[model samples]
Target: MTDSVALWFRTYHTAPAPRLRLVCFPHAGGAPTAYWSWARELPEDIEVLSACYPGRQDRLGDPYAPSVHAMADEIAAALAVLAADGVPLALFGHSMGSVVAHEVTLRLGAEHGVRPVRLFVSGSEAPHRREREESAAADDADFLAELRQLGHSSLADMDPGLLELVLPSIRGDNGWD
Candidate 1:
């Protein structure tokens, strides 16, 4: 991989490379940049990489998938290539991303034949036991409340411009059941 690509997945806040890779998935409406600060808090022995889902960040030009399975499949394929080099890896995800992480981990194991060493899920319930099916596009008040409950201080603060930028992804992801 080129230096920039390598840095994108490997380096963390100018620290030494880690023996294990911790791939993170952000919540709905979240981006890879959200995890940048986490690099400093984690141990130097653990590498940190975050998922850059389509329709967000530099991938905004790409089409967004409408289902969790599709997202999981894509992630599995990418991680399959990464794992081929024999690097141990784990997963960490929050909120909607937790569902993506769980499904992607299964897809990785069954489809790609790669199992993560561990999985960390936060601010979300078990994927299999998820309650209700509320379309994100349908609910504005409740949806914003859910975002607040997920601990998105910035979303809770609700600056008009930021809200304009993030709401589309949130609404899109809500329909991703």
Candidate 2:
């Protein structure tokens, strides 16, 4: 709803005069489209912008983010434009997104002199404590198995064709051979 940099974000819905803007960061092995339903259901006073990562959906050909820090920095720059518009901003993230949101918040202050009013982080460790899960997939088969075990029934039910589409991004996120 703003400018050229909007390309990195997907707006499933928007408000003309929102009390606050919420940017949703997708989890690893996930994409912005998953948050599509949220835009329609949230309060009218809240605007929703789901950040879309590269190498997925409309950015199928685009390269995946090289690292979480790099991705967060890029997202911070995009959010800067929205901040400039005088809208109160907030970030909501789950799992990997939680960490990305934190990093983005920090970058916004240090790099852009902007700060979000609230940062809601869920399903993530504290900033001072970080731990790596042993999800290093040895192969595609292993990666798919991990997803199924992760209790994502959707992954268990995914069609092979669709699975093919999403697996690479997941693997890339996992950073395993």
Candidate 2 residue-wise lDDT, 41-96, digit = tens: 88988988888888877888988888888888788888998788899899999988
User: How high is the CA lDDT of each candidate model?
Assistant: 0.77, 0.84
- C-alpha TM-scores of all predictions: 0.81, 0.90
lDDT of 1 by residue, 54-113 (tens): 678876666677798887877777788777768788999998779888998999899988
CA lDDT, candidate 1, residue 162: 76
Per-candidate Cα RMSD to the true structure, in Å, reads 3.5, 2.2
> Which candidate number has the best lDDT?
2
Error of 2 at 151 (Å): 3.2
